[model samples]
Target: MVTSPEEMQNEANKKFCVVVGNTVTGICTTSNAPADAKCTATDPGKVTVTSVPSDHLTILGTLSTTNIIMANWSKAMWQSVVNRAIRMLAWGPLGSHFFSAFATVN
Candidate 1:
């Protein structure tokens, strides 16, 4: 999890590329990311998945929906989502970016 602003900035600088299935969809770089991408950082706590049927079903459903959305997305749509994720990571409060990223995709 990210702990500080500097570390967050470093992560942003890593220029990680988004991949969907076998295709490289979008890249996160200092150039393409928003100007305020490194404003703040917060650690998003981890989740432990117990061997529960409900949890398994939830995960499976989420994964299935994600696959469908990703498969239907155009290159530009993927880029827009990626860019929005970067912007949220940069400007939103702490771990809020994660939700923003997925929410935008939906």
Candidate 2:
């Protein structure tokens, strides 16, 4: 569980939640995770599951759909580093330099 997805994105630049589907899908941010289960982050029903901190991620069924969305423990801070990187690239030198030099360094 990530404390703040927004901060993570700005600082780290990666998707906060894996949003796995089919019980557990597309949550392979860490190769250690079951990459074989590359399911999309689609709605996997409305079942409430307990979100486990990365510290407790080793526990079985720790990475559930509902739990991930509604948990208190946060192991790693999530963000949109990948997407932001693409955006920075798309913006070219102009966007990168503009934001880095003038943007608020929160």
Candidate 3:
């Protein structure tokens, strides 16, 4: 007979398998998960989900605007960003008039 305790198990009551700290050892939890999980040195890009009753917010995407005024505000913010980028380019070794040329092209 063989026993493999390393394998993760999510029973009806327990629904999460998460590493506590920097160690490879993990624990199972039945408690509610945080809104955003923490990242560790070993796993810097991913997070561990403690519990999930349902897949409600699995596909969170970009910000969305519904009103006309908010849409215009977004456009204004984007234009400002473009202008700033152009101004920064003007300060580069190219020349001080780079922003003017960029403004004309863009």
Candidate 4:
């Protein structure tokens, strides 16, 4: 799990591969929040998983409600994006072998 903001900052310059078996058809990065992540498949599709930045939060009143609302919206948006990406890949030319690699990476 992601721990610090510095980790996310460092990940900004790197591409974390999304592996299915031995194939790497996508890359991803974690956000400032531990539970948040974003992935971009080679099929040119993207997916995001959102999370609340608890570091910036307090046990407040209306703010908590707002945060919950925002989190829900983000979750919905993430699901929609991920679904679109999956649908695109499922119908794309690379879908069948996207998870199968002919060679190994050292």
C-alpha lDDT values of all predictions: 0.46, 0.36, 0.43, 0.47
Clashing pairs in 3: none
TM-score of each: 0.26, 0.15, 0.23, 0.24
Please tell me which predicted candidate would have the highest TM-score against the true structure: 1
What candidate 1 gets wrong by more than 4 Å, as runs, is: 1-66, 95-106
lDDT ranking, high to low:
4, 1, 3, 2
lDDT of 4: 0.47
Pairs with backbone N, CA or C atoms under 3 Å apart (clashes), candidate 2: 9-79, 9-80, 13-80, 13-81, 14-79, 14-80, 14-81, 26-39
Write model 3 residue lDDT over 42-69, tens digit each, in one string: 3432333444333532332355568887
lDDT of 2 by residue, 5-86 (tens): 6654434322234444423322223222222323232334311233435553332222333575544434332223334544
Each candidate structure's count of clashing pairs: 1, 8, 0, 0
Q: What are the per-residue Cα lDDT tens digits for candidate 1 across 1-106?
A: 5479887666555444444565444553442244454322232221111232334222111222358767887768866866875677657775532333333233
Deviating ranges (above 4 Å) for candidate 4: 1-73, 99-106
Q: What's model 1's lDDT at 50?
A: 22
Best first by TM-score, ranked: 1, 4, 3, 2
